[model samples]
Target: MPETAGPAEGTTAPAFTMPASGGRTVSSTDLAGKPYLLYFYPKADTPGCTKQACGIQEALPALGKTGLTVIGISPDPMKPIEKFAAKYNLTFPLASDEDHKVAEAYGVWVEKSMYGKTYMGMERSSFLVGADGKVAKVWRKVKPEAHAAQVLEAAKGL
Candidate 1:
């Protein structure tokens, strides 16, 4: 796939609503006027995905101080998302993008290759939306382990 970018900084964030873990629904409308982090990952319960989720969980207190809500989006349905959150004790919303609508809207759904094979999947990417609902920062092909700290630093600006 050709290289592409998500919404640029200062552009309004694309709106979305997805089913989340804990039988909840996360909607951009409800998050309106508040900063939030929307992260897209390839799969739930995998090593990288797990690390990324836990890191955000670890940063929750500080993130909460910044008043930044976080939502993890994946193409997997709610079952695995619920399991992953429970296993890791993640209290944030892990939204299910089973139809890939939100991922595509955010430009995180893309072509991928592994072991000489190619497929379509969610990229490890994140977008921090400011309180005004504009994109504040974008991290593409994110490093799982350091993601939370990076986001926390940026969230302080929101």
Candidate 2:
């Protein structure tokens, strides 16, 4: 995996365009004028990822009231993402970064080790983009449980 770098807080978010589930394209520009939460995960249908996604889903109404839009991104292809969304009844958009370009750009893809095995994959993380397109908060190596609530708290401050 390639090393990732990003602008500091209060700096403009790097521009990106990726294929989203449901055959749509989502771009950084498309998120203008609204605060958005961009979360990166390793794969779809996994326990942690499912918990994180469902947590976000359950908090959608509260997040919406706070004027925040949530988007989940993963290295998985669109087919799995579509199935995951349907299975979880996820209302938010989920982007597929099969090429890992977006994940690399966001600095979420990295070398990971588990059970004494090493491999390259996404390091679950989340970023809060303010209305001005600047990164307001970044949660690296995020924990699944209470993540949505934590993000909601941060979004409230934005």
Candidate 3:
């Protein structure tokens, strides 16, 4: 992870192009003219990450009703992400940031401490980007279990 700052609310989201599941390229610019969710997670196939992904998966209908598309980002490579999505039947796109470049740009990759040791990793977070391509809301240090419902509520208000 590199030292970078997060995009503030009402500011344009940092543009990125990353490999999505199934070897497709997905870019922030591709989402122009539509509201979308960009969620950053530490890793795939982990307990918390899986729970959060599934939660968002379950809430997709409501989010779709609100006219928002959800996309998940992580530092893991695409192969693992593909497996994770398959295992959980995820319908949303998951982008791989193997170098953590996009994660750093979003400010989700940062120094984290666990078990008294400090290291750089993706900090679980999410951003709601408006149809105009600016951030509408940010959820930092998110708790996985309730994240989807929380995001849904925020999207409804958007």
The global C-alpha lDDT for each of the candidates, from Candidate 1 onward, is 0.93, 0.89, 0.91
Clashing residue pairs in candidate 2, if any? Answer: none
RMSD, model 3, all Cα superposed?
A: 2.1
TM-scores for all candidates: the values are: 0.97, 0.94, 0.94
lDDT of 1 by residue, 1-158 (tens): 44556687889999998999999999999999999999999999999999999999999999999999999999998899999999999999999999998888888889899999989999999999998999999999999999999999999877
Question: So what's the TM-score on candidate 1?
Answer: 0.97
- Candidate 2 deviates by what RMSD? 1.8
Itemize residue pairs with steric clashes in candidate 3.
Answer: none
Give the runs in model 2 whose Cα sits over 4 Å from its true position: 1-4
Worst 10 contiguous positions by lDDT, candidate 2? 1-10
The number of the candidate with the highest lDDT is 1
* Tens digit of per-residue lDDT, candidate 3, span 1-158: 44337998999999999889866778878888989999999999999999999999999998999999899999998889999999999989999998999987888889999999999899999999999999999998899999999999989987
What C-alpha lDDT, on a 0 to 100 scale, does residue 144 get in candidate 3?
99
| Candidate 3 least-lDDT 10 residues | 1-10
Scored against the true structure, residue 28 in model 3 reaches a CA lDDT of 79
